[model samples]
Target chain A: MIAAGLDPIAQFELHKIQELKLGPIDISFTNSSLMMVFTVALIGLWLLLSTRKAALVPGRAQSIAEMSYEFIADMIRSTAGKDGLRFFPFVFSLFIFILFANLLGMIPFFFTTTSHIIVTFTFAMMVIGLVVVYGVWKNGFGFLKLFWPAGVPAVLKILLVTPLEIISFLSRPISLSVRLWANMFAGHILLKLFAGFMIMMVSAFGVFKGGLAALIPFSLTLALTPLEFLVAFVQAYVFALLTCVYLSDALHPGHH
Target chain B: MTYLFDMFGYGFAAAASAAETVADYKGDQDGGAAFPPFDPTYFPSQIFWLLVTFFVLYFMLSRIFLPRIGSMIEERSNRIADDLDMASRLQLQAEQAQSSYEQELADARAKAHNIGATTRASVEAEIAKDVEAADVEADRQQAGADARIATIRNQALKNIDKVAADVAAEIVEKIGGFTPNTATVKTAVG
Candidate 1:
């Protein structure tokens, strides 16, 4: 049953924090934009404060900075090898932005930038775009070999395999974007619904009946909060992980 | 009753309206349900900020932050390399010092043995010379003693010859004036 006045979708609604138009296009900054800036600003501040010393032996801030740097570096190395260092900046920033966005969404009343398909798709497209451009630039004709792998049996080498591989390659952005968006969207929606259910039950019946009855949704919502937090981390990791996998293909075309 | 038909008609109409709501949400219109995120209206703003944020992050990480961290890593690795090199060099130095010490010890031991051997040879040579001198001195003294004893025996033999001659003469005179010749007596004793 629908909760009377409580709309679960209401939290995702976007409103302009500032209205600024530039030549017929509404360039107004929304809550999502604010969070993006905040995410960037926070990372910038952390890096600034962290490496200010630039010590030979790192302090705590520098250690954390180095750890995150090495973490992304190792991810690329394991997935894409040494050749993937060129895309390090993009992948690193992409992961941090998404992780922060998802975590920010978990905060009560904070907007989830990655929850939007447009946002996630944009990031995914950027990753794929980098892959394609870098692949073509680096590997030339061999880039297409990513789809048509080597050492396939002659029977499977017909038009069947090539088209399927191409389809899978193109589906990278869609799957990547949808996976992140759906996870965040569904988790937030579930949490919102459970919380609304508790509110509905409590209001409909007085203290003992309502409170005791409401306990189920309340506890479930409580439980879901941590799950949503987990989703936030896993989805970000998956997004970055797939980004690295795709980049590995780009860097090494025929080997995959 | 006709009222029942009217109620049925109203129920169908309500369902139809609900279906319309779904269709409208499925539309690409603005102010629709928040379920769809592929809305073109939000794409521009999101894209702009994503570009902006990503650009800043990449610029900072690549140009500023990452390189700084890279240098620190490089510094640490260099320090470790230096430390390792120093350690190995020190190890070699210690090995050389130990070997030289052993070499010196061996040389001193050999020298001590040589000195002991030379001293023993010199002492043995001195004892041999001293014993030879003592043996010669003892031989000379014994020869002298043998010569003296030979002289003494010769003198006693001569005296016995003379006394025998005299006694023979006396016995000749006393015994019936039967005196032997002195020359014959001397010859017999000799």
Candidate 2:
């Protein structure tokens, strides 16, 4: 994996389309913001048009839309239980947005919004924020029960286990956001680096000179494409699954 | 190293803010400006757009899209149930028709057998009467034949007796030159 010039990481950089400054904050729209809006618009158009008729026997477009809907629906049902369906809309939106963002990023020059730490962290924070708000509003004193199991010995619970449980509960957002961000960032870099490698190999030697050698990096990039697609899906699934799991904690505090 | 900050439990917000400062791969690609993803400046704009999109998508799905799909599935299942019910009803009707047809065929066969039995009894009675009349006619014919034979036999005996008597008388006259009574000759011959 020889990575030379053309800074593979530069693809992640943001430039202001229209800079807006208020006080010390620069809230200007960037390439990352544009991609997010695009993903949302795509989601809306697909869902609305596909479901305009909402045929019992779905056509291909409707089938796709329905499958996506049921996919997130089933995730919420299985992981968070049936009672967790109230959060279905939120989880579905999150999943579709991230999924589209990840997939759309695969295009030649499109930005991957989820690859940003701040963006992914914001989503993570929102999930955690919901958990905190709903967990407290619903459970009250019982919310603290999330860190205290029913079966652990009282002394162990106070001395050893509660602190560990608290740490785990708090770490959910960090690990969730970091995991997604790091995977996408690393994968995109590798793809670009390999693509750059192929170009370098072909340009360095003429078609007659490096024709055989260029195929190596070209094949590597080709091979990585499918794997990147897999990562795109798997990472989105993991993110949504964890979101539901956290919502389960909100719905039924200390049940796990 | 920042992952350590994550592990040591800096809470999500703190860790995220800290991640903003880390210089990521500024290898003179574009005059070595700060890598945009890690730089904290664009986060506000990114967050603003995310918030807006998330809200819009959530409302659209919850309010409109999900319920439509839900009804679609429900309609198919209902139609299937109705079809199955109709099929079973038709099956039941077919079974009833088959049973009634079998019952009617059995009744028709029983009536045919009754008619055949009565016809055979009447025919047998007529045959017995004809046989009795034939037997009476044959007996009368045999009796008449027996009576005629008896009368003829008596006549034949009388003729034989007369002839013998006449011959005896004539012989006596020739030999002794005396005629015997015809009656006495006849008695001796008989």
Which regions in candidate 2 have their CA more than 4 angstroms from the true location?
Answer: A1-5, A21-24, B1-32, B96-190
**What TM-score against the true fold does each predicted structure earn?**
0.81, 0.73
Q: What is the lDDT of residue A239 in candidate 2?
A: 85
Clashing pairs in 1: none
Tell me model 1's lDDT, rounded to 2 decimals.
0.81
Scored against the true structure, residue A161 in model 2 reaches a CA lDDT of 92
Q: Tell the DockQ for candidate 1.
A: 0.24
C-alpha lDDT (0 to 100) for residue A219 of candidate 2? 94
Q: Each prediction's Cα RMSD?
A: 9.2, 7.8
Off by over 4 Å in 1: A1-5, A49-64, A153-155, B1-36, B73-122, B162-185
Query: How good is the docking of model 1, by CAPRI class?
Result: acceptable
Q: After superposition, how far is residue B140 of candidate 1 from its true place, in Å?
A: 2.8
User: Which lDDT value does model 1 have at A32?
Assistant: 83
The DockQ-derived docking category for candidate 2 is acceptable
What is the TM-score of chain A, computed separately for every candidate?
Answer: 0.93, 0.95
